[model samples]
Target chain A: MENKLKRKMLWLDAWDIEEQEAWFSHMSLQGWKLIGISKWMAEFEKCEPQKVNYRCDVFKLNDKSENNRIEFYKQSGWEHIATRGFIQVFRDMKGDNSLEIHTDPIEQAATLSILKQDITKRGILTLLLSVITLMLIVGAHQIDPVGNYLNDKFIETIVLIIAYMSISITMVNGMIHMSKLMKRLKSGSLLEHEKSYHRKIKRNKVVGITVIFILSLWVLTVFLNLMNSLQEDRFPAIPKTELPIVQMADFIDDFTYIDEEGLSYFKENSSFLVPRQYQLEQMVEVPGETWEDNSDIYSPSISSFGYEVRSEWLAKKFVQDLKEKHTYYAENYVKVPESKFDELWLSQGNFNAAFIARKHNKVYRVLYYGKGSIDEIIERALAKAER
Target chain B: MANDQRAPMTEAMYYVLLALYNPLHGYAVMDEVKKVSNGRIIMGPGTLYGILKRMQQENFIVLDELDGRRKIYHITENGREALKHEHQRLTCMVDDGKPLLGNGDSNGK
Candidate 1:
């Protein structure tokens, strides 16, 4: 038996945590009996030379009693030992930590190759992120493919909730880890002359990340509010009549005719046509003078009143357009024959569409129709369609 | 460099500090400390690593990571000064305590 005083434990500093664990596991795999870890410096310091007990903060490995033991300190040219036996294999499997900047050409070349490989991997990840960002930006216009309804809104809300929760969890976890690392790096209470440089670095990184997150949140809120307000403001007031000189040629090309029933059904089923208020114009084109009272027809005085009685006219025109146009939303309009049109218009008191209704003592009926920014959507959709 | 009051510290800490005082690697320092102490008060690999790490945080040591697993270390001027003080204090303590304990000295005073 070897003298008890002659045996020693080997201590290792692996390249990184994985290499360290691998080495420990490998030793155990080779039929070495596992020993318990030494939690503190004191336990390790109390180690008796050539003792069977081997200890470390991580896993502890002990060779079989018959195998010769070498004290880590007693071993000659340990750098060579570490570089040769288990350590060499460990470094090969992981990475070499022994290569200095002033290393010989061969080692330096190998290090450069590893660095190049890492850079390539990073480049690929960056490219993937950029492509994902670009796709989101380009696809922002139609972010909602499903019909717009309370359900779609509910789903969107859920998605936002999930995204927010994930981000919060990740940020909190990261912050906790960072704080722990900082604590480990800092020594005891600071002294007057002691500059805790690492603490300062940690604090700066945390503050910077937090500030960026806050700023992004603020910016996103403001941008969404602005878009919402713009949408609200752009829609014209309802019950107006001037028939805003829309080119008949453009309307004919852009729209197909639909029956009133079909229009109402489409509007009811479509998520997009939420019950929104609107402005309208009804043109009163009189047939060539069998009108006995022709003066009111051309009067500049009644121009502002065109919006007053527009609902009845709007209802009439809305139904007429359904018959004449294949547009989807129809329930927004209700048809009234020329007989009840005047009464319907005159009965409503002084509202924009109602005001115009009082003056029309018309002999013939008019049409009611749906309103939209179809012209605007037409321009955008046409470009995409072309592309 | 020789006259700093914070110099002349405990032999063990001083030698430990000095071994790492150069750009010597960590394991190399462990072996050297073993030789310097003649295997008495032998520095364990783990203890040396711990001290080296602690000293780094204290700004007394810096990792010379020009190599990977080898992790060479060097002492800062502050470390040198601290080691000197520790050496002085520990030596004084040992000298003062020996006679008092009636172990190694003739004069109890």
Candidate 2:
């Protein structure tokens, strides 16, 4: 085993078979014999700097036949150095002119097509899937912005989409190069010209590292934000009742009036994961506010839940859930789809009336029990959210 | 021409089969080709192995022997037939050019 070892980062496209072989040959002349290749990294065993011919081939094969291929190449004075995926790299100390596996340009092109074929087939499928996933995320944001905001899986989904797109672009780029090389071969271009990947390899390494750095920073920022939010009450208070989502309350036809004590206002701004949420729950002290309130008086109060959503998708989702859970049918439950806001008028249900509206980024979800129509109580709350 | 199905053979294929007629390993074939062509044609290991593998699979060549890491290959009857047909094609072109160029031309002036 050679004690001295070195590694190099490279981005070898499928058509780069010629370049990889040339680079390997050049490396051997500097006493570094390639020992292994894994994705972007190439490992070499250092030795006495000597002129040696090296070649890399790309082909699909099963393990059993691969053994035979390796054995055959070995028998031909070629030492198998490293294999990464479809690439097989070999080195030989034989005369520089005595190392080509395929002398015929036509044959060379045919063999190189193996990689092109694989990428063409699989790249299209992968590209299609990635595109579809991206479209789904866009649609999700449009359908319900609020739920999508609270969706903790957004970061992972975006990362996966980006990665898939990168892989897809690489595959497409490889295929394009393959076609160009094949065309040049068909039109009589020397194989030696495209054999030096020095500059390209350096550029690829920089790009690869830059992309990895950016992705790492993206994930790290989210993780750090989550950690910070978990450690401390991050967001500032929702500001003194400078404006409340719930202003006043009243009953419907029975003329149920407000308790005049002013609604009890409770404000909370909290965060879980990386997202922050502001919740404002105001209890309208009606004739029978709660089971205890009902025992004390006929004040049938409605507990309203409102949120200052961070995004449009989250706001949309909040409105959607409110409509699904609270809206009922028949005379007791009248659906008002044409209302200025998303409204449902009710006279006898658990929620006498439910009004869901979104102004800018803020969301208002009012479930009214004792109300003489949603306007009597929530008009001021709506005004506040609108403001 | 004999098979009618095999595409026109390339110079590399021709020399490879020609070199294998005497049973040679991949490196030897490369050297043999350069030697025969007077250093005009040089075959690399990648092209050498590719031709050998394809020829063997197509029955134009066969594994003659395996000595350690050197696998010696010999041209098969199919390889010989293919080479013979290529020879005929080249011969016709040479013969047809004989009258036009004047064999040993400078003397004709």
Best by TM-score: 2
lDDT of 2 by residue, A44-132 (tens): 88887787777776665465424456655665677778776777777774555454555567777777777778777877887888788
lDDT of each: 0.36, 0.64
Native contacts retained per candidate? 0.05, 0.61
Q: Candidate 1, residues A1-387: lDDT per residue as tens digits?
A: 222121123322221222233433444344332232332111111222221211112111242321112232223211211221121211111122221111122222222232234334544565556556545643641344222221124333434444444444444443444333234324322111122234433554465456556556655855775686676534233222323212212222333222222221100111122222112222222223222344533211011111211244543443333233322322122333352233222111121111112223111112222222332323322322233
DockQ of each: 0.05, 0.43
DockQ, candidate 2, vs. native dimer: 0.43
Q: In model 2, how large is the Cα lDDT of residue B25?
A: 68
Cα shift from native, residue A106, model 2 (Å): 2.5
Clashes in predicted model 2 = 38
- TM-score of candidate 2 against the unseen true structure: 0.70
**Residue-wise C-alpha lDDT for candidate 2, range B13-54, written one tens digit per residue:** 888877776888656787898887788888755667677778
Worst 10 residues of 2 chain B by lDDT: B1-10
Which residue segments of model 1 deviate by more than 4 Å? A1-154, A178-387, B1-15, B20-27, B37-81, B92-109
Every model's TM-score: 0.31, 0.70
